[model samples]
Target: MSFNVALSGLNAAQKDLDVTSNNIANVNTTGFKESRAEFVDVYAASLLSSSKTKVGDGVLTAEVAQQFSQGSIKFTNNSLDLAITGNGFFATVPELNSLETSYTRAGQFKLNQDNFIVNSQGGHLLGFPVNADGTSASVSLSTAEPIRIPTASGAPQKSSEVDIRMNLPAGDSFISSAPGNFDPEDPLTFNHSTSVTIFDSLGDSHIMTYYFIKDDPSVNPNEWMLFASVDGKPIDLEDPAGGGTNPVGGNISGPLSTGGGLTGARLVFDSSGDFQSQIPTAANGGIITSDFSNHLPNGADTSQTIQIDFNLDPLGPNPNEPTQFASNFEVTSLQQDGLAVGRLTGIDIGTDGLVRATYSNGTSEPLSRIAMVNFANEQGLKQVGNTAWKESITSGEALAGEGGSGTFGTINSSALEQSNVNLTSELIDLISAQRNFQANSRALEVDNQLNQTILQIR
Candidate 1:
């Protein structure tokens, strides 16, 4: 009986030392939990009708339960490196078709070739996917997709119409009466060259030139001012100061750009008696139009629409005019509107476990509010690898809750919780385990010696 008791002690001591060794070995491992060995002393039981016929043997090993106290989290420079605070584990979705859900505390992640956020094993991180409005509820952990941070918004639009819209000051130069009778056949012309940006059918952009010369009379001595419109609105047209007032010569004048000179047509009385020109000629650039309001059947203003579409196909028989694009742009209002363009810089976890991302545009957003779980019997949890545990029949269902609620602790970013293993306590326990094993071995030796003496006496 004494030998049996010593044998039990030795077994229990050996188990205790093993558990301690494991704890010490993984002291630096992330999310490693220390475990405690539990033991139960053997009891004698009666086997006869009075229940006193037999006695139980020695001690028994009850269990080696793990301590689930929160481990400290250290900050890593990688934005994808994540750490969970409190009791919750991250849900992961494997990339392959094999349906398997894995939970982990290791937040290390990276962007896959397709820009998917995935772990080292290519398991995608799970989270409620956000919509264009940045809100969602139809998603779950099992169906979470990779959340990609966008670099830019939609494509830049082409200039369908080049609109030069401005009120050219009605200057004192206008004789008010004499300037109104300006004729195109005679010659007092203001020649100017203006640059235009045009876009091709493939959305490629190009530069085009428009030269204007006002045909006024030399006898009038009044300089003729030519107005230029790119798409629909009037655009700035000025030649290199030395290019003089004529950007285009006589043979290349008017909307047609044909070898022939401009044909004079009757300036008509419109339905509103407005002085509307009868000829489809585009003086300067094209008839000033706003929002596609201008009309000319055979004008340089092609069907291209806007200035962003200004490029023409020189390959065509007549590159000057098949379908002209409109170019209308207003830059005054751009400065007036308070707009912001920012990029995501970094993300930080709050003490309350909220992940907040900062942007280069001086803006920030809450990525998600972290969730944690608690259990009725933590000791009953079945330990899985990687500092994670799963609920078993012994451990009750996980009680999911937010941080700062119940016994759940709040998380701190940039700070990790240190291990609960106290070197001093471990050292003391190690010494006790060693001594206990030695004492049990000595007792066994005594039992052997006593048996030998009895045999010798016999």
Candidate 2:
């Protein structure tokens, strides 16, 4: 019995040492959780005729339980590197991968060749796919598996509203004939032609500049004629070139916040490539009209935004919509050319886990959402090596939500999750386990010597 007890002590100590060694070995492993091997007492019953108190037993090896504490996050410059700040596992639905379904806190991720978000091993991060409009990619996660994101945006887009600034010379006044036409008594009426160019889906730019020419008050004052021009030709703005009709006929739409409208619009073009505009020319000799506007209005100038919307009823084989990106996403921008512009300038996930982008036009969009996943029974998880873990039946179903929602933490971009194992703690455990194992071996050797002596004496 004593020998058995000593052997059990040895076994337990060995196991404890093994556990500690593992912790120390994985000290730098991302998403790795430290562990400790438990020990239990083994006992034999000394039974008398009527026994109440039981004799104590020796020791036995027990299960190696894991410590599921959060690891410190290390910030890396890689946008693909993810970290779990709080409690939550990154939702991954692997395809053609080893684990059919699993969960993990190891946020070491990267962009695959296909632009699909994936683990270093090419296992993809499963999520709802985003459309061209950047909306919810998934309506149902059941039958429809998480989709892979492609590398490229579907197609480049054309801007809807362009800023046209033609100096009024501070002394010019106009009077027109129509109801919404320029009234000689009103300072709100337009006098010059304002044109803008819009690019198509194929990146072919069309010069659809508007002509804000007020029917030459000296000529037809009753009909504040509205004409549209394309590539320097006097186009019947009411009739766009190639096919579609023009949006601005007489008066441009009013601003949303305040009821302010711009009228006396004309589109003129000289298809002969001999287009000259004295009124619409910029101080730099460049056209004062642009397809996209960058606003930088200092002070309380009440920066304005003109929302010009157009549909994609193209002339040729093209299927797209007329859209524009403005202000750092969600916020609106002014009409000025350049100032404090933060248009989506290459969207990258922020340290806080927010997905935003930047544009040359000084606008951005809310792209993807990042969230960490935590496990109720992290010990119940199956290790997939490479600092990754998979959910097991014991780890319970995962809870999915956005960062900063529920018990999740905010995603800090360009950061990484460091390993949680402490080297010092592991080393201590290893020494303790090693000492116990050594003591147990000594005890066994002493017992063997005593048995030999007793046998010789007998």
On lDDT, the leading prediction is: 2
How does each model score on lDDT? 0.49, 0.51
- The root-mean-square deviation over C-alpha atoms between each candidate and the true structure, in angstroms, is 13.2, 13.5
TM-score of 2: 0.63
Each model's TM-score, in the order given? 0.54, 0.63
Clashes of 2: 46
- Identify the runs in model 2 with alpha carbons over 4 angstroms from their true place: 44-54, 93-99, 129-147, 153-167, 173-195, 207-229, 239-347, 350-375
Number of backbone-clashing residue pairs for each candidate, in the order shown: 52, 46
Q: Please write out the lDDT profile of model 2 over residues 1-458, one tens digit for every residue.
A: 66777887788887888888888888887777788787788656555533455544577666677777778878887767777677766666666343365566777887666656778665666544345455545433332233233334333453434443222221233443332443323325444445455444333444554434333434432222333334443222112221222233333322212333332223222222121222222333322222222221222222222222222222322122211111111112113222232233364765434455555544556555553456677677777776667767897755555566667666656677777888877777778888888999999998898889989994
**Residue 262's lDDT in candidate 2:** 30
The runs of at least 3 residues in candidate 1 whose Cα sits more than 4 Å from the true structure, single-residue gaps closed, are 47-57, 93-99, 112-115, 119-123, 136-289, 292-376, 397-419
